[model samples]
Target: MSVPSKPWDSELVAKWLEGRIEAAARDQATADRRGYGAEDDYDKAAAEEWVCRSLRTTARESEQAAFALRIKQLLDQEDYRITGIHDDRRVERHVRATLRKIAKMTKANEGFENKLRYQ
Candidate 1:
């Protein structure tokens, strides 16, 4: 039940989010140049689609970070409760199982999941 490592790095994710937001803004400018029924209107539609996708990506990353922080908080509380326990591996396994159960019980996006890896 151990949480697997996430392929996406938080710092890298943050950078990409920032880049996407900037791109979305820039695209908005391109999209604004055309009026209704004008030629090159497709650019505006495409730009809007990109903006929506970028916003969704941002939301996903934020949610993943919040979930990770929640897991860390749960782990910290568990550690505090199990002071002086000598069985480190067993303790970790139990903690992992508990965290997994809690995570699964929580609501999340239907088709998306993020792993919580210990640093």
Candidate 2:
């Protein structure tokens, strides 16, 4: 999938992450319930916890994406100026670095989702 050209909202990203996490947890809980051949609260809770633990990497990526987006937005703002950066080159460098970070996060997330899909 192609990354959106428009800027991403941090809140939206957070909500998306929460939804993904919840869905994964629910799927894990259901699978655990099926394997046990019965619905057990404790087992479901344990399965959810395990799923959350396994999704730490995904959560981290979401956080990085949000951070990168925020940095990009700040840099793009006309009024926001870096005190130390007197030259346009330095400012451009910062913007480029943030963009790279966003791109890296996007690629990593896509690869991770693809791995999950094949699994």
Candidate 3:
């Protein structure tokens, strides 16, 4: 079974859930002619599920980046690596990854979600 999260993060989780719901609505609408009545509530349920999944995924990724930055900084400070390592391709990949990380999975808190921003 999944473990519980802290109460302090409830708002953030709620926002995530809203986004998921919106996305699910769009998806379901596209998938079938008939839907489970109560379109609004169905969207809300999708959002809640999304929020739970998102918090776990994003937080874990952020932690990894934080760890990598710390490691790189420490290594640089040590003046080690006489030979070439972490080449341009490797560095570029991480840079792109870091940029993507900053984009966020949703803008649900702004009262929009599931759909791309400005949708």
Candidate 4:
């Protein structure tokens, strides 16, 4: 997977996640209003599931965004040298490998986000 050319808008994501949580809470309250019955039980369970999924997604995205920002800052330094490592080439390779891993994870997260949208 390739890293997205566009930067992640952390603020935008935060706002979106907030909206999702609020919506989920509203749905859960509606479900609760239906009273304790089979259909109500199902509705409550579904609402809980949606909330859990959203929270999980929010956590992952927040962590990834923070990691990406830190990596970008690290790369911006003029003389970023790892302790006890003199070979710049080795450091470069390690950074590149780490970046690739992050890209792969981000791609997977996008897929999950899409799945949630459709669900």
* lDDT, each prediction: 0.42, 0.43, 0.37, 0.45
Question: With candidate 4 superimposed using the best TM-score fit, by how many Å does residue 43's alpha carbon deviate from the native?
Answer: 7.2
RMSD of each: 19.3, 16.8, 15.7, 16.3
lDDT of candidate 1 at residue 37, scale 0 to 100 = 40
**lDDT by residue (tens digit), candidate 3, 10-75:** 345345445554665565454334454544333333333333343444433444344234334433
Give lDDT: candidate 2, residue 96.
50
Off by more than 4 A, model 1: 1-8, 37-119
Q: lDDT value for candidate 4?
A: 0.45
Candidate number achieving the greatest TM-score relative to the actual structure? 4
What's the TM-score of every candidate structure? 0.32, 0.33, 0.25, 0.39
Model 2 per-residue lDDT tens digits across residues 6-89 = 544444444444454566456545655566543343233333233333334444555645554544554465542333223444
- Please name the candidate that would achieve the greatest lDDT relative to the true structure: 4
Worst 10 residues of 1 by lDDT: 110-119
- Residue pairs that clash (backbone atoms under 3 angstroms), model 2: none
Q: Pick the winner on lDDT between candidates 2 and 4.
A: 4
List, residue by residue over 19-114, the lDDT tens digit for candidate 4: 545554565556567655434433433433333343344444665555445445544555433333334554455445444443444544442233
Best-first order by TM-score: 4, 2, 1, 3
| Candidate 2 error regions (>4 Å) | 1-4, 36-119
